[model samples]
Target chain A: MNELEKRLLDGFQRGFPLTERPFAEIARQLNAEEDQVIGALEGLSESGIISRVGAAFAPGGIGASTLAALAAPPERLEEIAELVNGFEEVNHNYEREHRLNLWFVITAPDRDGVDRVIAEISRRSGLEVLDLPMLESYRLNLGFDLQWS
Target chain B: MNGIPAIDHMDRQIVLATQEGLPLTARPYHAVAKRVGLEPQEVIVRMRRLLDQGVIRRIGVIPNHYALGYLGNGMAVWDVADESVLEMGRMIGDLDYVSHCYLRPRFPPEWPYNLFAMVHGHDRGQVLERVDKINAVMDEDARAHDVLFSTRILKKTGLRLPT
Candidate 1:
């Protein structure tokens, strides 16, 4: 990516604007036309530079989100991934290289519901649910420049 | 995502309009556009600019922590050996269980843990066990680390532009 693309990513991640003509405003700032700005973003999303274009909320603020994992064998990895991602409560899931194996975050309507969901998963998958809830938050910021030097 | 340009008031309106959650209905962008008093395409155009510039990282659902029953959540830091951290970090992050994992600059005197990952479990025991599993994958004499769990959630918002 060129310097301009890198700069745009940095600005988006750092401080996103909220406005009616937000793109037009951004175009004015970047000295680009609104159409150009829109087109570039479409291209960016198409190029897999970003996953999506929307809001990211804190799970607990509205409901509850937990970090849950299962020790799925190699044979059942795909099956497990499908099962875990099936639930509406399950938002993000990934494969980590740990003994625990499959790792996923479950978001629910309430904190108590997390336990029920885990129990249901445990029953279906027959995998022990190791639940780790957040006890304290020292530094919770996850914003970083995509092209930080 | 890369980076977006520093935004202005107009951009702030667009962001605020879509901040809470995008309507799941058809033409979700239309509602956002109407609220902002701009054409749907114009709103789309502006959203594109923000995405192009990396103004918005992603538009997705953020799990509710309290509702999830993951009462225990914390930033678990590890004192990983330099050689293994790069691989270890990726491995840990790859886990479907771990929501986030990354290497952060650690201060010697103040912050001892350079590698940080957010671990969420139903309880402290489960969280510790998960940490233990991650630790077992590391070198025997790897640097020590600690977990800074959140006792109370002060504030939780994705990204806020200067209004």
Candidate 2:
């Protein structure tokens, strides 16, 4: 990719626009047209450089949320992943390199739902879970600017 | 200055498109377009605007923290002499394994943890060892350092673009 493409990719990682005709608005600033902006983002996604272009909600702003993980055997990794992914509340899941190999985040309409989902995962996957709720939020902003970097 | 920044529906669509389908190939834009129903060029331009406005930060892959084998994830909070907090923040943020570092508004009697920095390692022992390394480099008068190892993670996603 060219330098311009790199810059574009870097920019999108922070956040996406939350307005009508957001692409056109972005185009107005980037010195490019709406079509060009849209195309570039699509290319970025195809390239594996940027994961996705969407809104990342502030924790607890949307609903109840919790970070949970499981200690699963290698043989059952696939099955466990499927079970966790089945829940709509399960947004992100990763196989971290730890005794807690299966890590995921679940958000629901309320605290009760969050608890119920965890219980379901335990029953179906047959793995013990470690649920970590946010005790204190210190500095929660994850926005990063690439042009500055 | 008055408003955080106002956005529109198209802008929201772009964010949704990217989040839903992150390209994993050489031509990410083309890949995203197929999913979002837009051309590669359009995606590129919109991203640039988001960057300029400081809405989007950088676009990069977040390596699986565990995949890198730095499994010991802990939030180390410190009560430093207010005078040296800024200097110390820079020092801590510079750590190779410290993915996030910052100072937040302090609420006394209820919240005392300040000067938060996230460090990860392969195990508790490794994480603790690094914490020791951090402590060793500290200047005098920095007190009450504590590590809150994340017992679990609830949600880890990018910022929600105003929609």
Candidate 3:
């Protein structure tokens, strides 16, 4: 990555300008033109170094969400993952290295929605769904501290 | 997201529009406003409200952890005493390498863990070391703990706005 790109990735994780022209504001900080900053950001985004330039919501602050898991046999892993992801509510699903391997997150407009999805998945998969809802959060995402070295 | 005040139709539009992310442009909000069929000022106001309300934690660049070389990702789960979960969670969260720490429900007789901390490192060895530090912190108060490394990221489509 180029120097400007490094700074863009490193420095702009948080506190992105909320002004009328945010790119221009970023440009001033990085000593680049507005279009150049925008172009660099676009390149970073396309390259998949950055996911997006937007808001990170507070989990369960708007809609109810729960971190859920299911243990799928090796043969049924893909099928079960598909089944879980089939719901619009299942946002993140991961194959963790454990017996209870299929970990996922479900978000819905309300507690009932979240519970219904979990119950449905549990019923369909025939595997026990672990509904591990957050009791308390110990950390706030201030943005990852990307190490350049 | 918890404690969401009733969002109007327009605010919901703005959330859905930006949920994927904002447009990469000189006037990204303007672009979002136009697409969502609202004026730029209104979009800005709504977004500001969302941020202030904690519905939107922060408005900024979201980086991919894997792309950023955080290869060692593990969800370390500890079966700790219920009374001390908050204290233990705070202790774990204070660690630099631990990205997230939370007290989650445990499914006993099968899964027995309450405290979950997401530890990130450039590789597994580093992650293990960090997990070891967590073990050291709790000592015997942690009845048992296990680090479930992510073998594969099957899906990571982040948070979805409830439709």
DockQ of each: 0.05, 0.09, 0.74
Off by over 4 Å in 2: A12-19, A145-149, B1-163
TM-score of chain A of each: 0.88, 0.81, 0.97
Strongest candidate by TM-score: 3
lDDT of prediction 1: 0.60
Candidates 1 and 2, the one with greater lDDT: 2
Q: What TM-score results for chain B in every one of the models?
A: 0.78, 0.77, 0.92
Q: After superposition, how far is residue A10 of candidate 1 from its true place, in Å?
A: 1.7
lDDT of 3 by residue, B62-142 (tens): 988888789898999999998888788889998878888888888987889999999999999999998998899899889
List model 1 lDDT by residue over B30-81, tens digit each.
Answer: 7887898888888777766665554544443233444446656656778776
Which residue runs of candidate 1 sit more than 4 Å off their true CA positions? A140-142, B1-30, B33-163
Q: What CAPRI-style quality would you assign to candidate 1?
A: incorrect
Candidate 3 Cα deviation (angstroms), residue B111:
1.6
**Highest-scoring model, DockQ:** 3
How do all models score by TM-score?
0.54, 0.53, 0.96
Off by over 4 Å in 3: B1-6
lDDT of 1 by residue, A1-91 (tens): 5555555665654334445455566667788877776666665555656433456543343345676667788798788778876776665
What is the iRMSD of the candidate numbered 3?
A: 1.6
